[model samples]
Target: MLQINNINKAFGTTRVLQNISLELPKGETLAVLGRSGCGKTTLLKIIAGLLPADAGEILQNDQRQNELPPQRRNAVYLYQEALLFPHLNVWENIAFGLRLRKTPENELKNRVEALLVHLGLQAEARRMPQALSGGQKQRVAFGRAIIIEPQVLLLDEPFGALDPETRSQMQDFYQKTAEQLQLSAVFVTHDLKEALRMGTRWAYLDQGQLQTYPTREAFVRDPKTGIEQEIEFWKNV
Candidate 1:
């Protein structure tokens, strides 16, 4: 379980996150929806240990991670871009983390091969980053992160750069992978439909304050989530 207790952050005089608190149980994805500049990324950064929180505690599995560095925190942050190593091929890129940990050669080979199949990258294993399409590159990036099995995955609009068709495909792929691995993640996105599709639980952020819902129904019922507006817009069309 990941527990964020009264997390607060500021940039100079501007408060970016104010008393943000939420709980993310293991094996579930908490989809956070917000517009740009709403501090969604700031909260994720604090949880990933990439930024200091002026006040609050970050606990993973009941252990405090406030003072831990990003590498030691057992949390992985994925950005909007795939950010795969340009020099490495798909298989090598996916195996990068395991190599760093000195995983047994046989085990690493088996694992990487399985992940390539899982990611539908088997035929592209030898292809370099530039050779793969955007969706394929993102799949390789996800494989690299999943190989290490981080305690929590912090996604910062990971599919935002993809075309609509590829984005939908990636979302479907992620839902399957999450269930298969029983992954725990905090998925951040501005798209309401995407959030509704991706999250088991939901939250909204505005002006640094967070609003959480106990169920999707409640989240959709709330006017601030814009679900009602979306429904109305579609109905009139």
Candidate 2:
């Protein structure tokens, strides 16, 4: 399980996250939904160790993750953009992390090839990011993240760049992959429908605070929670 306790973060005088706390169990997916400037991305970054929290601690199981850097956390983060290496081909970009960790050539080849197949990117394995469609690039990014088999996965509007049709397909692919890997995922999105489709449980974030719902039905029926309010707000957008 990934546990976040009283996490607080600030950028100079601007406080982005305050007393944020969350817990995600293995094989469970949690969606973080909020309006712009609500600190959703900041929270995901802090958890992934990309940014330091001013207060509180993050833990995996019982191990302290306070001092661990992004690379040491075994927490993979997928940004809004695919962020693939401009100079590397699809296979190389997906194998980048493994290469950094000195994984054997045969092992790397097998793993990357398997992920390519799993993500339906086998035909594009040799293609450059520049040659792929928005949806395909996102798939490659997701494939790279999962190649490491991280204990926790953090997604920050990973599908925001794709069109509606592609976004829906990617959401389904992500859910299935997460289940297959039994990954604990924290996905950040402004789309309520996407959240409802992707997460087993939903967390509503407002002004840096997070409140979780046990299920989507509970979230939708109440229409009182921040998530429901945001959902209604976006319906007309």
Candidate 3:
């Protein structure tokens, strides 16, 4: 389980996160929906150890992580960009993290090969980053992150750059992969449908505060979520 306890943050006089708190149980995704500049990314950054919270405790499976660095926190953060190494091919890119730990050569080969097949990248294993499409590059990124099986995955609009069709496909791929791996993640997106599809638990963020919902019904009913407005827009058309 991942728990955020009374998290707070500020930039000089401007408060970005105000007493943000929530829990993500194992094998679940907490989708946070918010418009641009609503502190969603700030919350994820704090949880991933990329930024310090003015005050809060980050707990992973009951262990406190206030002072741990990003690498040691066992949480992996992926940006909208795939951010793969330009020098590495698909195969090497997926194997990078395991290599960092100096995983045995044979085990690394076995793992990377399996993930290649799992990600349908076996045919493109030797291809360089530039040769892959946007969706394919993101797939490689996901494979790289998941290969190490981190305790938590932090995604910052991971599919935001993709075209509509590719975005839908990636969303399906993510949902399947998350279930297969029993992934525990915090996915933040501004797209309402994406939020509804990706999250097992839901929350809304605005102006530095967060509101978590107990059920999908509650989330849809909340006026601030804009679900009602979305429905009305479609119905009148």
Candidate 4:
């Protein structure tokens, strides 16, 4: 479980996050929805140890991690753009983390090869990131992050750049892969439908405050979520 205890952060004189608290269960994905600059990314960065919170505590399974660096946090952040290394092939990128940890060559190869098949990239193992399409590149990015066996996976609009059709496919793939891997994740997005489709639990952040919805119905019914507005807009189309 990832326990965020009344975390707060600010930039200069502006408050970015205000006393945020949430409990992310193990093997569950949290979908955080908010407008741009609403502090969703800041919260994720703090949990990943890329930023420091001005108050409260970050815990992984209840263990304090306030001072841990990004590398030591065991939480991988996946950006919207497929930030694969320009110099590495698909196979190399997936194996990069394992190599850094000094895993045996044979074990590393097996792990990367397995993930390649799982992500339907077996045929492109030797291909560079430039050779893959947007969806494929993002899948490779996902594989790279997962191969390291992170305790928490942070996704900041990871599929936002894909075309609508590809976005739908990626959401389906994300749901499937997450369950198959039993990975814990925090997904940040501005799209309500995407959040509803991809997460088991939902949260909303606006103007530095946050509220969580453990069930989809609650999120849809909440007055501040704007989900009903989006739904009504689509229903008349």
Give the number of the best model, judged by lDDT.
Answer: 3
Winner on TM-score between 1 and 4 is 1
**Model 4 regions more than 4 Å off:** none
Residue pairs with backbone overlap in model 4: none
lDDT of each: 0.95, 0.87, 0.97, 0.94
How would you encode candidate 1's per-residue C-alpha lDDT over 35-137 as one tens digit per residue? 9999999999999999999999999989999999998997989999999999899999999999999999999999999999899899999988999899998
* lDDT by residue (tens digit), candidate 3, 1-237: 999999999999999999899999989999999999999899999999999999989999999998999999989999999999999999999999999999999999999999999999999999999999999999999999999999999999999999999999999999999999999999999999999999999999999999999999999999999999999999999
Q: What does candidate 4's lDDT look like per residue over 1-237, in tens digits?
A: 899999999999999999999998888999999999999999999999999999999999878999988999999999999999989999999998999999999999899999999999999999999999999999999999999989999999999999999999999999999998899999999998898888899999999999998689999999798989888998999
lDDT of 2 by residue, 1-237 (tens): 999999999888988888988889888889887888999988988888888899998999979898988889999989989999989999999999899999999999999998888988888889989999999999898888888888988999999989989988998888888888888899989887887888888888888788788777777766545556776678979
Our model 1 lands, by Cα RMSD against the true structure, at 0.6
Which residue pairs clash in candidate 1? Answer: none
Models, CA RMSD each: 0.6, 2.4, 0.5, 0.9
Cα displacement (Å) at residue 51, model 1: 0.5
Model 2: runs farther than 4 Å from truth? 222-237
| Candidate 1: Cα lDDT at 55 | 100
Q: Sort the candidates on TM-score, descending order.
A: 3, 1, 4, 2
Candidate 2, residue 85: lDDT: 91
